[model samples]
Target: MIGKTFSHYKILEKLGEGGMGVVYLAEDSKLERKVAIKFLPRHFATHSDEWERFKIEAKAAAALNHPNIATIHAIEEVNDEIFIVMEYIDGQELKEKISKGPITIEESIKIAIQITEGLNAAHEKDIVHRDIKSSNIMITEKGKVKIMDFGLAKIRGGVQLTKEQSALGTAAYMSPEQARGEPTDHGADIWAFG
Candidate 1:
C-alpha cells in the first residue's frame, strides 16, 4: 500500500507491523500533517470476529482523550480495507529503553508516574487495558508517555469477549488470574504494571 492514498492520507512509508495490523507513516493531505495509519491485514480482515474486535479497539481507544494515551483520529474503510488513523509519535518503545540498559531510579519513577496516570484515565472510563507491558508503552522525544494498543481491552459492562478459562495477553505480563484463565478486572493491569 506504499505510495497509495487512502482517504486523504498518502502513505509515505511503513513504520511497523504487529499481530493486529501494519502501521504506516502517512501524510494527511487535507490537514497537511503527518499521521500513522494502521491497516488490518487482508487475511485477518476476512474473519468477522477479528474484524469486529479491531473495530472495537478503535472505538474503545477513541472514546479516551488523554495526553498520556495515543489519540485515534479516525477509523476508516477504503476499498473494503479497514484502517485506523492515529497520532504519530516520535520516540522509542519503553521495551527498547529497558533493554538497552538499566534506567535510573528517577527516570523509572517518572515513567511509572506517567503510566499510572494513563491507566487511571482509562480505568476511570471503565475501560480495562488487559494488555499492559513495556512494548505497548511509548516514550516520546519530550519524555512523555503514550499508552497504545487497546486491542485486548475489555469494556466494563460490555459483552464478554473471551470465553471462560481463556487466557489472553503476553504470558510474562499476565496476572495470576489471567494466567489461570479466570475473569479479570482493572486489577489485572496493576499486576502487569508491577
Candidate 2:
C-alpha cells in the first residue's frame, strides 16, 4: 500500500497487524496531518458479520472523546477496501513496558488512574469496553495513557454482537462472568482493571 493514495490519504508505512486487520501510518493530504489507518482484512471484509462489527467499532469509539482514549477520525471505504482513520499515537503498548521490566510505583499508579478515568468516561456513555488487556493500552512518549481498540466493546442496550461464551477478551484479563460465557457489564471492566 506504500505510495498508494486512498481518498486524500497517502499510505506511508505499516504500523502493525492484528486479528481485525493491518494498521498503517498515512498522511491526510487534505488536513495535512498524520493518521493511523486500520484496514479490514480482505478475508474478514468478505464476512458480513465481521464487516458489520467493523463499522460498529468506528461508531462506538467515534462517540467518545477523552485524552486517555484514542480518537477516531473517519471510517471510509475506497474501492471495496474498508478502513478506519484514527488519531496517530506515537507510543508503546503498555504490555511491552511490563515485559521489559517492572515499572516504578508512581508511574504504575499514574497509568492505573488514567485507565480508570478513560473507562469511567466510556461507562458514562453506556459503553462497556469488553477488552482491557495491557496490549490494548498505550503509553505515550510523554507519559500519557490512551486506551485503544474498542472493536469488542458492547454498547449498553444495543443488540448482542457476539456469541455467548465465546470469550472475546484475552484469557488472562477476562472477567469470570465473561469466561463463563454469561452477560457482562461495566463491572467486567472493573474486574479487569483490578
Query: Per-prediction count of colliding residue pairs?
Result: 0, 1
C-alpha positional error of residue 17 in candidate 2 after TM-score superposition, expressed in Å = 1.7
Q: Provide the lowest-lDDT 10-residue window in model 2.
A: 159-168
Backbone clash pairs for candidate 2 read 165-181
Residue 107 lDDT in model 2? 96
TM-score of each: 0.94, 0.95
lDDT of 2 by residue, 1-194 (tens): 98899999999999888767889999999999999999999988888889888888889899999999999999999988999999999999999989999999999999999999999999999889888889889999899999988878888888677766577777787899888878889998999889
lDDT of 1: 0.90
Per-residue lDDT of model 1, residues 1-194, tens digit only? 89999889999999888768999999999999999899999987888777887888888899999999999999999988889999999899999998999999999999999999999999999888899999899999889999988878788888676767888888999999989988888999999999
Alpha carbon lDDT at 175, candidate 2: 92
